[model samples]
Target: MKKTIALLIITLMVSPVYALEALSDDALQNVEGQAGADLSLKLSINHKLENDKYVFDNGTGAVCADVQFCRLAVSVNNRFIDNNGQASSGDGYKLWLVFKGIQGTINIQKLGLDGMDLSYKDDGGADKIKAAMQLSFDATKPIEIRNFGFNALAFGQDKFLTTAGVEAGSTNASDYGYLQVTRYDTSNAPGSVYDHGRETGFMGVQMNGNLALQGKVMMFGCDASHPRC
Candidate 1:
């Protein structure tokens, strides 16, 4: 038994050697050339701004009614796909939403996963979604979020995270504070809003209405606590 175990160990150690399939001279040269080929990409999003139709609060995150649905689109390599997998070259992706202002936490009642459509210059590599995910959030005031629920890696490809980040910010009283997640749901949404407790730092993304907490309000420093505020 001891001799058999020793042989098995040796065999396992040498297995990769046989699995290495060697290529021919021309194949090897072509493979080497392809390795140095230039592969670049860019991602852009198009969205139409709308009135504050989504319900937001310092207590309950965000809630959207069916009557008010905004649109979000993503454009990459001159092509786009909707959340339902329809492809278009002129317009990329279009996601429905309800906008709000005034900072708070977010929790989706039923978050769904939408796959991605990618276009590459060279088609030598595998054709599959490299990553996919869903995200959730918690609410706070004086505006803070610290918890996240994530669902990721749907297919048998690479491990992914569903939740991305929790973001909050505000400007005027009409559009001053809001919270949001990275996924959409038509039913049974699951998420939460964090007011205060031990679960504060669990959120990866946070925006503060005040600047003393090291958080940014508007992308351009609109909610300044300094003399400019």
Candidate 2:
């Protein structure tokens, strides 16, 4: 009995399953965002990113998506504001879009505007990139982007991903959205200020303003290239 008990203990100690179970609680906690600011996160499950049909709306105001995937669009506007209710105009703000829960492999064919142009030719199966709010997983952090846009983000599964958009409201608060925002104030930093989201598999951040953003805590997993999804 003593020998059998020792053998069982040794077997459990060397198991990969045991190693996964040994992950620290803090490791899990690392995925959750801080408690101070309100964070809006959306993650889709089983969806693939497409580059040809996705579009940026530019806030031109014309029921923009008058068409379907052939002309689907999302309007984005940005500007700066100070602590004392002042709006800083002139190509004012930066916009970022977040993608979470991308399993398998993600190939970003286009990175929409604000300083980073999406191009599959450039990334070529690169695991991760952080150009704007789009967390391609490169650089491990989001880069502040200005003057770039995208047509669409293509993925394999449509139902597996969630998207979260954050409009930092005045006073350091934030607003969350899934599909779109009807009307938001772009005046004197007194409106929805910051915007961003998270993907379960990864998260990205881009600082267009000097708002001092922080790291995002996330919960995500991935399936390696294999026969069984």
lDDT of each: 0.27, 0.30
Residue 168 Cα positional deviation in candidate 1, in Å, after optimal superposition: 36
Lowest summed lDDT across 10 adjacent residues in model 2 is found at: 154-163
lDDT of 2 by residue, 112-141 (tens): 222222222222454331222222222322
Worst 10 residues of 1 by lDDT: 150-159
Off by over 4 Å in 2: 1-4, 10-52, 57-229
**Deviating ranges (above 4 Å) for candidate 1:** 1-63, 66-77, 81-205, 213-229
TM-score of each: 0.17, 0.14
Deviation from native of the Cα of residue 30 in model 1, angstroms:
75
Model 1 scores a C-alpha lDDT of 0.27
- Model 2: lDDT of residue 14: 92
